[model samples]
Target: MRSSVRERETVARWDVARPSWPSRTAGVSLAGFRDSSAGPVDVPLVPHPAVTLVVEFGDGLFVVGDATGRQQRGSLVAGLAPGAVRMRGENVTCVEVRLSPVVAYAVLGVCPAELDRTVVALDDLWGRDLSRIREQLADAASWEDRFALTDSLLARRRETGPLVDPEVARVWDRIVISRGRVRIEDLADEVGWSRRLLWSRFRSQIGLPPKRAATLVRFRHAAHRLAAGDNAVRVAADCGYVDQSHLHREVVAFTGMTPSTLAGDPGLAVDDIAWAEPVAHLGVMRKT
Candidate 1:
């Protein structure tokens, strides 16, 4: 009966309809993908800023490196393709979780808050069986369940506060209402703090700084558009990138491949990219 229950709890194993990994060069057995053009992942590792959740339906392992392509602590890294990041085990496994970039920053506050040189043990933050999350996430479940779990995990990290501070809350309100055209200078002025001072505090609290956060916001917005399957060049210009190369660079930073590669990856999952985005600079976004 438990076995039957488990079967119904998840989509039939064969029911997982995955995209054909467009590029054979992406490597390994590919088997899952997400439409990131929606918004930041309900999980965190934003492949395009909006693609927060990735579903994986297979196994593989990989080596991870930083923006410099060197292995280091706190550097962003991820599993290559279906099984990109390698561990000692001969076999690997997974399911999928849709997370938000904010979730990573909030949870990772216990460590150095930059993506450079960071080697994250997926089991340390979430459970070892990445697939278990999907089992618990069935249609028959309660909506509050996930949010409650998120809150509980967050409490462990001690990242809960004025999600939008009373002071910052007002500013967040202004920023959000502005519809993605906000500037760091204007926010600093509104918050009654110097741009530098505000940035310092922002980094401490948000894990990432403000300007980069703005990039995240823009990427999320643009990715949502990209999921619609528009021309890459046209989409790049509309997203405020200087050109498709700029878009390609960001895509590579988040995901280890290029935009020309298959956007619909049947094998990529959020846990795989536990820490792979390059910082713009030492204290900024990742550039590798």
Candidate 2:
């Protein structure tokens, strides 16, 4: 499952790999990346609709920083829709896991509400267990082995961790299935919960209120479409935006970049290879 990505007109290349099969746990996906460039790499981190765990194992420095200038070194966890972040490193190698907010609570041993829009050291949450997992991944012989180790770790954590309310999970699935176009009121009706109850439960369990979650999902879809070279005007309409300006605003809010700049972002360019399965799970595809 190894693929090579070389940006046009540049010497940057990435060795990206994915698991041979899906994770045993649902709502989890993994990808591995090893930088092949001659020097340090810095890429803007685009906001997405899932919690992210980066397990760094290479003999290099890995740093994540937010717009506020806070930085965390080594492996880290980013909450859903962490705004205006960046990743920088030299000779980076890591297995990146994207966990749907629906299951992130169980797998991460913390309420999503607690992680909302923040980046934290994985060691702060997982403590010594994070160290053991990093060692296991570094000792693994191949990317497939690393993926297996990660999946096993997540499955074990999920078994012992608390679960989100079923109603909340249902609403999340609906939001994703509609590509964030579903109304919160409609979701409340479908789940037989009052608007107030739905908002509270969804916010605590999903790390974001229903409307904000919907906006994040919608923005994720539009961002990927823009990254695929779609015109902002057409993408806005297709992704439920009022107009191109609406899409531009959301893009700026989420990534601190205009739609055109995001289209050429190096971080997103590798998504087609690194996140193919997860992107497909979201019912979107990168343009070939």
Q: Largest TM-score belongs to which candidate? A: 2
lDDT of the candidates, in the order given: 0.39, 0.85
Candidate 1 lDDT, 1-288, residue by residue in tens: 435323321321111222221212111122222222222221223332211222222232322343444432211223212111212211222222332333434443432244321345454444533335434433213323433333344355434422323454354445435534588898988889888887777665444566765665565455545543577898788777889899887666654556654243322222222222321211111111
**lDDT of the structure predicted as candidate 1:** 0.39
The weakest ten consecutive residues by lDDT in model 2 span 279-288
Q: What TM-score fits each model? A: 0.48, 0.93
- What are the runs in model 1 whose C-alpha is more than 4 Å off? 1-119, 122-180, 267-288
- Candidate 2, clashing residue pairs? none
Q: lDDT by residue for model 2 over 208-256, one digit each (tens)?
A: 9999999999998988898767888999999999999999998999999
